[model samples]
Target: MGVDIGLEKFLATSDGVLVKPPQFFKTLQGKLKSLQRRLSRKQKRSKNYEKQRLKVARLHHKIDNRRKDFHFKQAHALCDAGDLVFMEDLDYRVSAKGMFGKHLLDAAFGQFRTIVKYVCWKRGKFFAEVDARGTSQKCPECGGEVKKDLSVRIHDCPHCGYKTDRDVADGQNIRNRGIKLMSTVGQTGMETACADELPGVGLTLPRQVSQPRKGKTRKPKK
Candidate 1:
């Protein structure tokens, strides 16, 4: 399942390897410092000044490309290996603000999903977006809700007494949502409901196909 990176509680308890996200800022900061030195030495608007400016811009361009490449590779690796992916669908506009905002935005959680989605589509896999609003606070076992401040790392569910690594709970909650969703569609026995959503709760099987095909007409009886 897809889990948002940065939720330390979930990652710590998760069953897989944790690779620290690459730092593009470190690379950009170095490029900017060098550019500043060159700009300081050049006369404003002069031909040489413009050339140096373009060089700096080119470096920035390359750095951006590299950052995207890394994110895609990591995200693709996660998405490709799993039959289904569950990840937080964060409100980037609101969540990505302030000092760490740019860094968080740079993580481009949204972009990661987009890339993962296209790849999943190509491979006939399933991709699901878990709502982030209460995922971190809800108990996976008994649907208990807990109010927690950001500093509270442990997910202590008062109602159900279910305790877990917060991120793991969120991940499990995400997985549970996928299960509930399948149940809902399956209950109705409506092919449309189950057709697109990820299928086979927790098994990572692709969603069942529904709806009749088009583009070819049946011939009259011989």
Candidate 2:
């Protein structure tokens, strides 16, 4: 599956699935702001100030934890949906400096992509990052350039008459690029390793090997 991360939605997959952004920080923004106000009003180094400071810190931590948890769950879900997953290789930091920086930072596209890669590795699934240029501007069907502004949410290809949601088309284009890349360069060592460990390769491990363990567990002595 090809996944296109965007501002409007958290992501859109080539399979026509759209995952909405949870915006964890945004949801708690007002409360967080109030906490910060209360903390700022308290005298420095005082007991009440320290308590309020901790409250602010805890809210930040809560947002971080929620975002991380969401990323892990979505990553596993993506792995379950496809054996091979592809995403854009663009640097999200550059985009985060733009006008929608706050929203982009809240969405945390880079972190989610990293989690997805890790989940794919843990699950013995194939994962690759493809060139991101023109993903949203090109036609997935005809491979022709179909230019449009950011405001344009739908992809309309005049050459091939292909039409679809802009982000979904981007996902398909990413998928196409990944397939081409794989065909041209063949599988990387990582992909080959993953393939070898999967069922069809005549190698099998315990079910727990492919599934993430829940809660905390102590490591056994060697």
Candidate 3:
């Protein structure tokens, strides 16, 4: 199923109201500052410049690897636990070009989804990706437009006083969209009655995880 990787938390209400711990953002800010400092000092194409560039690249690579590891673990766990998985038809080729482009690429949402779908396929589970149109900005309860700037993490509905965790609300909205899409095709989600009766969606086989060649181990085996 499609899931957004965000700081996991609970919702206080229906409207998405994000409440991030002070340290959470402070740590991110610190990392960004470090990256900026390193990036600013390096000359355009000198040897030292290349070295500094690699250093920054390694930092980003480490972050990306860690995030991917987590996503893989979570996706595997979900596949193990559920027989059906539904997610958004995310087109990262276009979406990864925004202000958060680099971060999004590093986060590897597309890769995570591919891994998840592959795992589902391997285990004979259902997998599907539906449209994600207006999933974030639209109110799930009333179908009203909830306009807010990117800086405004809190999704407060002045009309209904509804509030919730931003990511969680988005997940709920995504689930609704997936459900609607499925319904139009004469299908239902796991939450609906008889949803389990529907045929499992198709999935491609997951590629084998690569490893170093047989003699490549740094420590020779006894």
How close to the true structure is residue 138 of candidate 3, measured as C-alpha lDDT?
Answer: 68
Whole-model Cα lDDT of every candidate shown, in order: 0.69, 0.92, 0.62
lDDT of 2 by residue, 66-178 (tens): 99999999899899899999999989899999989999999999999999999999999999999998898899999999999989999999998999999999999999999
Q: Report the alpha-carbon TM-score of model 3 versus the true structure.
A: 0.54
Q: How many backbone clashes does candidate 1 have?
A: 3
lDDT string for model 3 (34-131, tens) is 87687788788888878877777776666656666766676677676556666667687686888766555555667778888888888888777767
Which candidate has the top score in TM-score? 2
Winner by TM-score between candidate 3 and candidate 1: 1
Give the per-residue Cα lDDT of candidate 2 at 99.
89
Candidate 1 lands at a TM-score of 0.71
lDDT of 1 by residue, 1-222 (tens): 646566232132133445565657665786788887998899998999999998888877877788778766766676556777766666666767665776666566666667777777877777777666787777878887787877886788888788866666666777778667767867888765565676653434456855567899888998
lDDT of 1 at 62: 79
Order of models, best lDDT first: 2, 1, 3
